[model samples]
Target: MSRNAEHDHSLVMGLDFGTDSVRALVVDAATGEELAGEVAYYRRWSAGMYCDPAENRFRQHPLDYIEGMEAAVRGALAKLPPGAAARVVGIGVDTTGSTPAPVDVHGRPLALLPEFSENPNAMFILWKDHTAVEEAGEINHAARHWGGTDFTKYVGGVYSSEWFWAKILHVLRHDEDVRSAAFSWVEQCDWIPALLTGTEDPRRIKRSRCAAGHKAMWHEDWGGLPPEEFLVHIDPLLQGLPGRLYTATYTADKPAGRLTPAWAERLGLPPGIPVAVGAVDAHVGAVGGGITPGVLVKIMGTSTCDIMVVPKEKIGTKLISGICGQVDGSVIPGLIGLEAGQSAYGDVYAWFKELLSWPLKALLPESSLVNRETGEKLRRELEDDLLRRLSEEAAWIPAGSTGLLALDWLNGRRTPYADQTLKGAVVGLTLGSTAPKVFRALVEATAFGSKAINEHLMKEGLEIREVIALGGIARKNDFVMQVLADVLDMPIKVAAADQACALGAAMFGAVAAGLYPKVEEAQKKMGRGFSQAYTPDPEKAATYQNLYKDYLNLGKMLEAAWSSAGEATPLR
Candidate 1:
């Protein structure tokens, strides 16, 4: 119950490798006070890098992660109090998951090799990538009818193209060079900690239970990954690759290893500091936001990741249907971490913003309203403040006033049956609809998507005790949170920390450094309190209840059409 005296002046650093950027945070391990933080965006990634969104082929070069992490660390260290770096004793990392890349025997991502540097197939297959849609379909078909252990059981009811095996298979089938060369695959979360700890050897990399169970179909019940026979049946190329993969996985509470001398020198940190095993960003974000049993925390950013922890005994033998998998020790040690998400949330709003401003960009190239020369700055101002102004206007319109509804699936569905081929739709649109109406409908669509995920969890008998929300959107957008509260008919608490994921990583860092016994103990000392609470309006909740049924009908209609066209419908 007492703080560590030796660590009283010490700090633990947390690095969060997100989709667009890597963020660093320096926190006092004893007092839980944040000292400094930094964010370094992937420079090449921002400029469209090696990605082709049009093809659903999103890839990130290894150097982006490497440079960004170091830059973020340097940026954070530079802002800290003089001599603070010497006080830093441990490091923790978290990143977007299912983002696995093929690596050589030496543990180098193939994309970093000179010959494969530009090959998309050799790069990290991002979680949002849908290039493996067909491959995922093949996996689902094999799992359902193959008469072996259903690998998809633990990973929701469906395997997603956005996950490990499907992405790997897609690359293997399409790129002969990569197929012949890749010795093994490594998830980004696993690779980063291993990279820092000075071991990339596939044999020695400590895989994360969070990443492997949720995305890679790894379960202790199956002994490890799916049997080699089952994998070979799906594709002969998979022979022996399972052996190359790990059987044991560790939770973030444990130390992955000591920081290597090379990385310590590169990052200007002390050598031999313990590095905690990595996890997906949102799982750690849950810890940062104080996710306990029955408390659900939503990391609402470009996309939404809902994280919850429950007693392992309570979750016994109940494979919650159609969710991003649940894993023991995924969030905190001795508990089960449950994950679910919408692939598009703020992205739906971003899509609406782009849709409304398309003609301005496409048709008004030289107009005084848009040009830099103009004092009015109408176009530039609009581009910057569109969402804010629209949010204000959208707030005025009553729930369901748009007579329109949208499916929040611009990036395809990610949860409650993880189908990537499912597309978005705006139904009931009429000539009377304006930009504000359309925008509000899009926002409502995301809220509705969240409700569906909640419903799925509830159907599996998991009670919704308390709802906590965090991340960029949750903290910034009051209107969205209120709308979400109405849709779910639940009061929502939003975390105050601007960088909750980084704080969570620091909690792990503290525990790994022996500052605390477990993640829960560290969280009690380091947790960021809620900044705001949104209570659902009775009238709005009543209105949304009816609208939700309509939304469900629309989804069924679209999904039926998609299924009839030979694509699989989401599992119930």
Candidate 2:
């Protein structure tokens, strides 16, 4: 067979570790064909262990990740043709991030140790966890007043509780056992690649540029992380912590190392296959969707991650304010990746569903209308169909027909200034307000939140030439997309691939394995063009324009109220 024919048959695997599950996708590197995919939910996470929604603490055990990855990879391989597994030459990984875990000197998560088995602080602190709000506030204050370099300049000028340093400080200050045992910390993206490559020493593990630059205050300007003197000023507990962590970071296109024999055997893949460096899910998804200059890719799932890449020369010395971060090579090599997002998106709708279903959960099994089994089945059916039914009904209510207005801050705002202390609100509620009308208002509120981020980006001189959407909500929900298009007054394109993030990882994997010379070549060969487009309706756009002004005014009012009540200081 010719070299071109051999290239056409090569395969790669993309592993995506999400909030609730892990997804593995097997792809043809030459054709972009998705051979097979499997999703495995984390058993412990599904059982609701080690998380407290009331306290805003969400942690995941390393065992869940290990087990789920094995199951997903093996399951995906089993669905392929006989002997197809041997064709796999590379693996790429992406995970929800700024999700950092405490690790011992050997680069093992603390949760794996017998002594810290049950401690939440020992597990991976999930990105949605907001227990570190006070710590984040202190960091933000110190970054501005410390008389040294402003470390938070590139990260939207505000550090978030949902990020790396704040979470580590929160855990260290609260848990003495974990603090003593932890020799270093690792982001979920960095940890997975390190585990696969058998890089056990904390200092030797390859850190992800995507994770380190975006969440860890790592920049080329300051020689990596903030200086030790500045950290000690934030808190004495953070003293000397910087010395144990990494200084160098690599982009996803580079190979972290070859997959170890143990990991390869467990996943039914060959030993010594190149493993591409890991990255946050949104950045990977952007690559899968064919992101380019002036284009924005929004990964909309439970929350939303908006990603855009600009040339390094174009973004020189311009710090975009009120975003997540702008990091070099965080997405594509030689480009600066800019991220911004909401802490809650579909989650806002889920909250309403849970609230409305309280009576069904509380009374279904006890009712005389049915037996326990039948009641349980009925409850499940109702809950599963609730969003679909709401969307159908909500679609009929024209914009501004409902006077209700809401704030999509139930989990607190993530971008346009990161503040977790702010709570969601619903105003203009009356006896005549039906469930669907209120739901429409909620959907509009989320769209308004997105527009805020876009406006902020454009305000800082980044042009959004086009908008692309991906993830579960983007694929499944039509009402939300149409409303979003109307609110932003821009047409939105939905990526065709169901698992764009996983597919993106595979593209990077192909590059790492030398199947392609660069990411652009891989993307051109493997990219799945958009499936559909949502065009803005001019009349509806006009209506949303007026409604958007109302949203901003109400948001300002709420911020003032919070500040006056001493609940929190407005960061912006």
Off by over 4 Å in 2: 1-8, 563-572
Evaluate model 2: give its lDDT.
0.92
For residues 135-223, write the lDDT of model 1, one tens digit per residue. 88888888888897788888786888889999999899889999888999999999999999988689899999899889988888988
Structure candidate 2, residue pairs in collision: none
Model 2 vs. true fold: TM: 0.98
What's the CA error at residue 500 for candidate 2, in Å?
0.3
What C-alpha lDDT does candidate 1 achieve relative to the native structure?
0.88
- How does residue 480 of candidate 1 score in lDDT? 89
Cα lDDT of model 2 by residue, 1-572, tens digit:
11341346999999999999999999998888899999999999999999999999999999999999999999999999999999999999999998999999999999999999999999999999999998998898898888989899999888989999999999999999999999999999989999999999988888999999889999999999988999999999988888899899999988999999998899999999999999999999999988999999999999999999999899888998888899999999999999999999999999999999998999998999899999999999999999999999999998889989998989998888888888888999999999999999999999999999998889889999999999999999999999999999999999999899999999999888888878888889899999999999999999999998888888888887763223233533
**Clashes per model (N, Cα, C within 3 A):** 0, 0
In candidate 2, how many Å is residue 452 off?
Answer: 0.7
